[model samples]
Target: MVLWENLQAVLAQRGVAGFGVTTAAPFPEMAARLEDAVASGRSAGLPFTFGDPATAADIRVSFPWASRLVVVATSYLPAAGSPGAGVPGRARIARFATRDHYRPLREALEAVAGLLTAAGHRAAVVSDDHRLVDRAAAVRAGVGWPGKSTLVLVPGAGPWVLLGSVVTDAELPVSEPMRRTCGTCVACLPACPTGAIVAPGMLDARRCLAAVLQSAGWIPLELRAAVGDRLYGCDDCLEACPPGDRALATATAEQGSVDVSRLLAMDDATLRAEFPHFYVPRNSGRWLRRNCLVVLGNTGGAAAIGVLAGYAGHRDSMLRGHAVWALGRIDDPRGRGVLTRVAASDPDAAVVAEAATALAGTLTG
Candidate 1:
């Protein structure tokens, strides 16, 4: 108890904001998963050790061991007037992924780890590394529950919060569970554009736009159409939550609104300059460009025809395929020749079929 008070003071004085500390469930299933992920070399940048629970148990059994878990929620609201605001011609970026936080979050947890070590406890900090479910751990540590959109929504900060965890061999007083407050509200469910939420708590990752975007390379046609100009993560579910809306508005106020048009107008060098930290380039420029084209197609007007046409002959097959689809939606004479050329040589059956259909309409017109 005295140790808990000391640690709490350390966090408060260091400008570290958080809810409270809680204990992890001593379950074999959790331990096994952590072991498997770490042993298989899958826990590259993750924070948990392969034998974390065992290590803690060993220390407690043989020595005067204390085990405690501290969870923190950091505000990662985007800049005021960010591109997340409702606008045409630009794609949306998930607020956390868009801004830089992984580095700072890591630093804060390191401080917590140092405090635990100084108190005669072994400590480790956990961050998301594309494998571990840190959110689940945080939730169990009484941080928060999974919102309907499947994002962890901490009370005051809402779902815009980023989570971090500190697992230590320090026996400290545990904080009471933060009660699940998602009572009777299904706002996040309907907010999902493609109905990907499936049910209240389960998410079908295949249909999730954020998961899909991270999956660069060859994108399916139906999915591409659903992309709807969102080059990065989809915020429909988050923006749909009643609590989430206020958070986004608050985030918007703090960070500014995000304009899609500003993003669409960027050249290669300009995009690099504007978004150097973005992960959009993992699939190269084609995926994001294709997403912008899809958004333009959805908006359907004479305005974006030139922009779609410009990418009609892009070197990447993925970009060319999506460009043809965008041009098909535009239904302009300017797109006919390019669509014909694409239809004639396209190796992908889906792209060819759509191109043929569009070219047929052009010939008849």
Candidate 2:
């Protein structure tokens, strides 16, 4: 018991915002919920969420002697006045991805695990890994309750905290689950631009702007408009919650708004170094460029049309299609000329179709 208390203190000193211990039991209910979600197509396009239910539900499967689970929350919120303010002609990234919180969270958990090992107990640390359903562990440990946005909402920190856990054989005292709930507050439901939140605690990843942005391939036309100027992740749902405002106020802003024009001009190496925390698919710059094109269409001025015109004949169908879309959105004479050329000569069927559709929209509008 004394060791557990000391471990908690150590985590706090190391900047872990909140933490709790719980029995390392399989999360049968969570597993069932995941299965149902997948069956309903709510988990569409997310490969990470489609593993064997039993494996994710049971920590003991990975660490057979596991008896206790220590779940920890780390706040990635930037300090006050750290440039989180929205910038016109720039893209907004989700709050959580502003910095690499996983590294520090892992270190803190490992430290706790070391203490357990020194006491003759085995330990395994996991953070942002696919091995366990981290949210379930946090909920069971009383670290926080799951918010409607599908984020673990810490008491004062709201949903701006990242979650991780340390599974061990130590028989530490367990914390009771939180009794709090979001209740009748449906703020996040209407706030989702793509209406991804179908229920109080349910989220459909297919329609989620954040999920779509992270996903590889072309952005679906229907959801493209709702994506707005967000280049990476969406924060509309979190921003709408009352508690979320407080969390933002206290969080240290780690990143400033991204300049879409600058991003479009960057090469692979430049993009990777500029946003190291971003999940750039296969270390390719095309994904970032793809997103930047969307932002350009949404917020760019006459200057953007010239920049976008360059990609009108891009070899990559995804880029060429999006470039056509941006050209149509800008609706400038130069952009129109490029679109006409792509519509007539682009070899890719998808790109040709998109160009024709975009050109038609321009003529009609």
**Candidate 1 residue lDDT tens string, 233-312:** 76777667665556566554433233444555576667655655556535255555666677776664567777777666
lDDT of each: 0.64, 0.81
Candidate 1 C-alpha error for residue 101, in Å? 3.3
Q: Worst ten-residue run, lDDT, model 1?
A: 56-65
Q: Cα RMSD (Å) per model?
A: 5.8, 1.9
**Evaluated with lDDT, which candidate comes out highest?**
2
Cα lDDT over the full model 1: 0.64
**Per-candidate TM-score against the hidden true structure:** 0.77, 0.95
lDDT of 2 by residue, 192-303 (tens): 9888999878899999988888888999998887877888887788778876677677655346477887887788799878878877668678888898888788778677
Q: What is the lDDT of residue 283 in candidate 2?
A: 69
Best by TM-score: 2
Error of 1 at 214 (Å): 1.8
